[model samples]
Target: MTVVQVSAGWVPLAAALLLTVATAAAALDGVLAARAGGRPLGEGLLTPAAETARLFRQRRRTTVAADLPLQRIGGAGLLTAALLMVTVVPFGRWTVADLSVGVVWFNAMDVLLWAALWLAGWGPNSVHPLVAGHRFLAQALSYELPLMFALTTPAVAAGSLRLGDLVAAQSGLWFVVWMPVAFVVFCAGVLAFSAWGPFSAALGGGATGGVLAESAGVDRWLVTAGRYALLTAGAAFGATAFLGGGHGPLLPAWLWVLVKTALLLAVLVALRRRLPVVRPERLTVPAWLVVLPLVLVQLLVVSVVVVVRG
Candidate 1:
């Protein structure tokens, strides 16, 4: 088992900053994934940097009668929600908060995305962004319950909500191997929450960028960065909840955390290129009828196993 140490004052701050870097790296990797297919890899690697500089140089636009406070909050809330979710995510043996109810903590932060995206989409007072915000709410209904059930499987197996305890429980076997459906569903939820890949209905191309349609300059930059940051946090959480966290031999535990998170992040990013954007309307039925039942069964199986073993 990994040794647990009380984090120093700077630990949480450092973890937050580390998550920012990870988010950036994930964004860069995503750019690479999009451009690397049948093309030079160098171009893909540099795309994020180029885009960042361009966004940085762009001027802020003034929206007539826009709710500035809500707009700013919505833009920044993406990163805020992402950072909050990582508080209980252990790096090596360290976590920021390490709450007894870490699973619930993660769920709470994820739940905040509904407000963040909605406020953002509504703040602009544009038809497209308003539509985007509504779409996200509809999308949330489809994924949130299944996501909760998926997360429950691990907590049930560990018999605790503490993330560290969950990691410890996985020392014998990774949860992903045992609960593949839950893992898949959880990953899908990650994409849904982050508005990534197939689940990116909030910023769909159909509406000419949807939530991002009216956003420009720094406003657009923050929204885009926040989405990627959320994706990074989800990947890290998945690594901790399913991949035995930092458990590994030879290298330091921290490195293992980074490796696993990066792998998941890359897969999420690559998925954007592989799959078409899934419409919220199309997903509603399947999410309720198909994925939800599958995840519930996974939860049931886990509960029964835990009872038998108990």
Candidate 2:
């Protein structure tokens, strides 16, 4: 496969545009999900806009001894992490930074969420938010290793950390067909970190919005936007990594990429309505004992295949 280098300026601009689109799409998807579940249209869609306007006029809330700086970091960092992650994601053979270690680069961006969400939860100086932060941290422990192993399966199969090479290796067959477990685990990790679907304990209804219990005004808006952005970015990355990137028949590669990403995001949004939210505590044993081992086995299979093919 030949390397296609895009102009540095054009690539960053394109990535930024796509990231904006993805965030908007995610916001719309959330509204749609609520609508599908019989939520009022005004409440589902216009509510966020109205709330944002209201928040802009409202004063920021603070708790005694609250770490304002840390809270800002947590709220803003989520969007920043999502943007950085998307930079390395190729949309039909174009990426902002098609680094040689693109897979690892992707992993590094994902790991940033551990800090982002934690700060968001802990900085509020409140009990529910602190508990919410602890939940997400425990969640990281359970899912991170499996996620790493899941990522390794494709890297091993393609014999390259570069996403373009990984996509090229799927010209004949997509990795999702063979690495089904990895794809599933990867999606689970996506939902977990993004605080989406049934894995939304960090912002669950039980805790009166969990980590979001105390957030108000722009802080609330930023964190909420960041959550959806994370979901959108995760779905797009999952598409490139598992669903053949942009390779498809009849349509332009970029269109194909967009379609796959939209479908995945729909599935993710629909899942929240369809499935019961699983508490982080319940996820721990299964993630560590069951999912992690399955991910490792998938990695082993990929390794053996690569060796045999060579």
Candidate 3:
């Protein structure tokens, strides 16, 4: 690669590192905010931390009906999957491991969702946890297909799976301008994967926070940390794919990444308050049969535009 390409490559990795630090800060900030309000530090460790403390304080209830091993495996699996997804993400121009099949790698990593959620549900051997896990499984089936199809919209436009190439292609205009529908679809997928609002069926109120309901202490912390990391990854992907990556006229590449990522994260966090959770069953039918198909059509439209322009 040329010097510019090499320099560009570091953008994503740098963005990823910055995101890690920012998330740590945010988690810490959440803790501080809670403490200032007269809550325990552990309670303030962000929502995940508080949940962890709750789990740790509770009695370690065991039943002959539970698959203990599976529960442990599931929790660990979620963390692993999140980590794996981060590997292929381009922060700005740099990626830790950029491959021509970067997009495929992302899709492949998502397979861990099934194993992780199943383990969480089955291992707990409780009705609430099990029900939550099954709910997640059903929700996953609904959203994953559409998410993949949405991702393909950008790949089709760029004509490459390499995220770096995708970013580079946006020298003048970002993909979001041409593929607004796909961009919306991609955001929706991210929200669903993160179990964010409107798609948080796996984390419904009654089930003790769903799959992670029974987890305690460090286990809960890890799950929560992994989630922030996942969100950062998703934001980075969106920025890289659609928001011009690290390209900005006056600012440094890293700054551009930070700006874009923060914006995306803000939007995501804000949506928490704006959107209501949808039932898993409603999502399954409408998201797939209707929403996903529309995304595919959007992809086709984008492709036509690209072809015409070419």
Highest lDDT scorer: 1
**CA lDDT of each candidate?**
0.84, 0.82, 0.71
Candidate 3 regions with alpha-carbon error over 4 angstroms: 1-65, 205-207
Of candidates 3 and 1, the better by lDDT: 1
Q: Candidate 2: TM-score?
A: 0.92
Question: For model 3, how does the per-residue alpha-carbon lDDT over 1-310 read when each residue is reduced to its tens digit?
Answer: 1012344555555546744654653465466557667888776556544555676676555566678777777766665666677666565545567778888887777667776777777787877778888888888888888889888888888889987778778878888998888888888887777676677778653335887667665555555655566566677678878898888888877678778977887677557555678888877788877998898899789889879989
lDDT score, candidate 1, position 261: 88
Poorest 10 consecutive residues of model 3 by lDDT? Answer: 1-10
Q: Write the per-residue lDDT of candidate 2 for residues 74-105, one digit (tens) a residue.
A: 98888888888877778786677778998898
> Each prediction's Cα RMSD?
2.0, 2.2, 4.4
In terms of lDDT, the poorest run of 10 residues in model 2 is 21-30
- The residue pairs in collision within model 2 are none
Better of 2 and 3 by TM-score: 2
Residue 189, model 2, lDDT: 87
What is the C-alpha lDDT profile of model 1 across 93-182, one tens digit per residue?
Answer: 777777899999999999998998888888888888888999999999999999999998999999999999989999889999999999
